[model samples]
Target: MTKRSAGTTASPRPGRRRLVIGAAVLAAVLLLFWQRDRLSPRRAPSEDDLLAASPAQSAGSAPGRDQAGPKPRWVGSKNAGTGEDAEASARQIAEKRLERARHTLEGYVQATRYPPGARPLSEKPDLQKPHSVAKNTLPLARPDHKLTDARVTLEQDRLYLVGDEAARLVASCTTSDGPARCEVLRAEARVPETMPQASTMPPARVAFADEGAGGSTIAALFAPAKEGFGGYHGPIAINLDLRIEGEEGAAQFNVVYTPAPPARLTGDVREVIENGSLCLYLRLAVDKPGRYVVVGRVDDAEGDGFAYLEHNDPLGAGAQEAKMCIFGKLVLDERAKSPFVLRDVEAYLLKEDTYPDRELVPGRDGPFHTTKAYPESVFSDAEWQSEERDRHIKEFTKDVKEAEGELEALP
Candidate 1:
């Protein structure tokens, strides 16, 4: 009986040992899995994994799924094949540049016509106080010939009249002629000028605005100096023969000849005749020869008023006494409620035989220079004052260094 019991115990021991080994293997496998989970980098689920984890549903009604298995996630990136956005951005930038250029040109024209008080300190000339009109020194003369050979040039969509003969013809037309007569001649001239012509002729003046923008027609006439016109040899009368370019229009405007205070629009001074051009003639009776200003509301036929214009004629020493024609461009807009608003004004000097050959007259003292000085009161804040002071000091130091270098280079 004892031998039989011992045999049974040995068989049970082998079975028990096998069971213990199996348990140990299972624990080791679990530990390896835990270590891998803690140490290895986690990866986003693949498309297949996502599909397997998603709840089972009808193929047609799956969540976040279209006809395809899954909807594509959109990342913020531009497609290589599509360039429409880039092209549109570039076009907008180009348009802005063109607009800035046009405005700058208009401003220059207006600056030339600014009055003494309105002008920058550097450009302002000496003038006498307000005084009564003296005897006229020059007799008014009109353009005798018709502008038959004038031609038009379209640049940047703007129309400019070009032709020496045409300029001479228009310059000859006397402002004394009633506005109706002047308008007739001007309209007649435009008819032929608008037609195609040779491109060799020099540009006389800008005649019309770009398409869809407003247009203007201007003719400046000079009268021969009389015995006492001003104290010097300048023109006795300056006739601004102007008409709206596009359609027939009219507006009430006042012409303020500086030294003489601003005056109301009187029939004798401003008359709107049937033809549409406003014939503005200024008879000079000043005691000296210097710069003068003419300010007023001279509207085009479309009710667009003249903003500003600059005219500089460098007459030959000998011909300064003769009648001289000055051509200039001006800015006009319907947005300007007051003709007195001065912005982007400039004056370009025109050269002609009647005038001397000289450098173009400087319109303003310096680029970005203005008559108004910056006030120190603006720098009341310590931070702002400090920053500005530092900037000015830096500029001054740089200027001094440059001067020293220039001096060293000089003999």
Candidate 2:
């Protein structure tokens, strides 16, 4: 009967039970302390940081898989070259955008000059009837700087603009091994205060082939007007950038410049007559004083996937009409038009005086997917075409209404 009470601890000789429990708790705390140094941090990442760290995440690839990084909402995938590489997707969205931009620029180029006759060139067999240069108060020629079939040097994994024509202008590029990585080449043309007094007169009668000598994409940047040339001379500068992408090999481009008032513009009419181009007369007022750069560019894109077209032209008499084939070839359509026409062009200014090195977009040679520069001023498309004015007005009204609705909804 003197055996320890049923509920009492046999070892509790005065508070021994409480001391045993305390020692057990101490052992547990020591165990936890030994492992506390192995934890990680937790916080949300900024969007840019997330993108900078994992460029391919949005492309549906596991992070770190894509070198072009994430595709920006503004860009679209397109193919703008020929040969085996033509089948490859352009890492830069500029490839696709350039196509759209060319349509617009084609309009300008056409407008700048006249096709050989009033009728379409394809319908006219006497393509050389009254041979003449396309008209442009402000004319542009393939610069002395020329480029060749863009050669992707497999050995170096870089691209070179070579060939007899490539020797004209100075340019350079750097390449990489990745598919999206493009060896971007850049060339600069300093716009003279006046058209350089050329030893060679303008081509007597300029002719543009559906397939021209220049490769898929090309750009021309005009500098501030220099001294000498009258009427055509002024503070105006144009930086035209263009390219063509997609399965269509045909390149189209256009640009419209309204002469500042006090500076009148006139055209030879015959110049544009040969090209079936359009012309516009603009009266500009120099409310602002500055030099402007008006730019134009083009790209001959070969469509891919669903964009590929196939057909052949019909031969005469007993000859069978060739099935029109557009496989990776550009086809000219009447519908393509210009994308942008900037006025009051000024020197490019940024938060940083120097141009920042942008990340090369996937399938591109540089971070910027497109080479087209933005308008330096708050100008509108309406300034280019009266048709665009109405749309611009509607857009403004919609914006005002949306802002009002948002204001009303706010607490």
Candidate 3:
């Protein structure tokens, strides 16, 4: 080393100085990386790392883990979001179905209470006689000869049958004299040209005698139409009268008149035979139980013939109003011989009766009992049941409310 001056420094090794500088630089770089690693976000672990750290995955490798089967795949957050969406959709569908069921129940309740059709009559008819025409004509003979000799005559608008020829006609000719003799007898009883033809005759006016005190009467007038009646050749302007008489205090009465035959019928009235005869059935309820009478005259449309029926029978009473069914049947004469048939039959509650206890024959079965079956009105058993209808409406309403609450809690 040479003697150095006070202001001059000795020369150092180039390699050593360079190495020191490099080492300093390298240390600064390492320190900077360490600081970054601490402050910056760490790299997230791979799926494999996460699975290895999980308890379920670790349990799969542990004893008895195989018996439980491999751990179910971990559901990701995206899958969890999908599950929540599916649950929300299902709840909405269930809520809509319940709402519809509730509305249907409400509709059923209204229809059952107020049925669609004619309502019961609220007021009674005025007990005055209807305007009508009267005629007196002789009865015609039946077409077939085997029948008995018969004659029909009108007196004061009342039609009467003087002979039983119609009975003989229906029954087989039973005579020891011989079939030829029966035929001769039948021919001799033929309808004469001089006699008044029923077809050409005008309509008749009729009146009935009023019963004693507290008695009620009703008269129904019918205007003849051309339809329904068969083979009728005469003018269509015929009028028919139906009369009813009731005992004292007979306040409640219901009459349903159907021009066309009923589609469905039930009860005792259904047993009656409707062949060839015009039929009428009645439903009567009395506040005061007693005897009642229904009288009317029926004519053939073709003016071939007519018949009359008088129903006199006692009606009974109990805790409720006395109920009775009266059926009227008018047999047509020689229905096939003439095209004239019965049509446009109508009924009227002419008279109402109060409670009167009278000993009378019960109406016999045949064309005289309630013949046509029809459903009763609101109070009648034939209508819809009220109690059952209310029950269904209440039940459906409860279900809808419960579903709504469940949906609200879902989210």
Candidate 4:
């Protein structure tokens, strides 16, 4: 070992050099781990962790030493899903939609402007139907069959003009089963309310043949008149006890009758195309003078219903007139043909500023007025318009647009 060759170098200290290299490698590995942790993002404490901290941090701390802090139970609830959370989001979206719909309808009901004769005409609603309580429906079954239901109707006009001729009452009798006969066993009349004469009156029988497979007729029951009970004045209750020929029990039918009114429709009716509308001037024998409302129905040539017409005004006693006008566009929309029939008519006299505002008039039996066939070119097809109707339609349109934009932001 002491003898050295001229070209050879001294040997290295292998054990000492290896120890130094090992220490340096360990330090480099730790440096890489520290840099990686610093570069990546650190998570914030969850709501649960914040609630569980503070007091615990102070209690566990001491001078010159740090205690372990609360580890996050969860990263965040933003990504932590639940069924209840999904339901709450859905509920918020639905409530917004319903509130928007209510606003749209409120605007529609506020607008009431319409064209002339523009109001729809039809029968009175059940709430306004006179003496609706007196509609007689009684129980009776056919003698021959168990489930054979029989029905009877005593039909009368709105009023019978007080005159020499008796008020005609027609009994419409029918059976549910096929082809059954019917007859009136007995009939009588009584006033619905307190009247001066309250005695029951006999109903004279009328002979008529059976009409249809399920229908039979009993005609002519006169309105009662005596001393204080003038036949002319009645809100009379006509009670009819009847027997279906093959049915067992008697069927009791009743109808409330109005026998007289303050006014009557006369024999004359005149029609003309006035102001591009069909106007019918109804002649009236106005025995009592006051406000009058004349209502009627007009039908197309083919018998399809077209328009409802009404004329409201004040009048004096004796011969006077009221005209029911059909709007021009109504006929144009219907594309109606000429010879339009006035199918039905009714009239009432308004009591001068009273609670029972109006009284009934006789209803028309059939088509009351007929017009000469006029060409379709006479009418205009344009929509009826006014300032109020125009403004309401535009405002409602804008409401719909604003609601749509708000819906887009929701899930």
Evaluate all candidate structures by whole-model CA lDDT and list the values in order: 0.26, 0.24, 0.30, 0.57
lDDT of 1 by residue, 180-239 (tens): 222322211111122233132222222321221122123322111111111121111112
Runs off by more than 4 Å, candidate 4:
1-137, 141-185, 193-217, 223-232, 242-260, 266-276, 301-304, 316-319, 351-358, 362-364, 372-375, 385-402, 408-411
Candidate 3's displacement at residue 346, Å, is: 10
How far in Å is the alpha carbon of 380 misplaced in model 3? 19
Q: Which 10 consecutive residues of model 1 have the lowest summed lDDT?
A: 157-166
Report the CA-based lDDT of candidate 4 relative to the real structure.
0.57
The global Cα lDDT (0 to 1) of model 1 is 0.26
TM-score of each: 0.15, 0.17, 0.20, 0.53
**Alpha-carbon RMSD, candidate 3:** 34.4
Give the poorly placed runs of model 1, Cα more than 4 Å off: 1-276, 297-411
Predictions ranked by lDDT, top down?
Answer: 4, 3, 1, 2
Best by TM-score: 4
Tell me the tens digit of each residue's lDDT in model 4 across 216-281.
765664644421235434455555555675565544333333346778888478877866776778
Q: Whole-model lDDT, candidate 2?
A: 0.24
What's model 2's TM-score? 0.17
Winner of 1 and 2 under TM-score = 2
Better of 1 and 4 by lDDT: 4
Model 3 regions more than 4 Å off = 1-81, 115-385
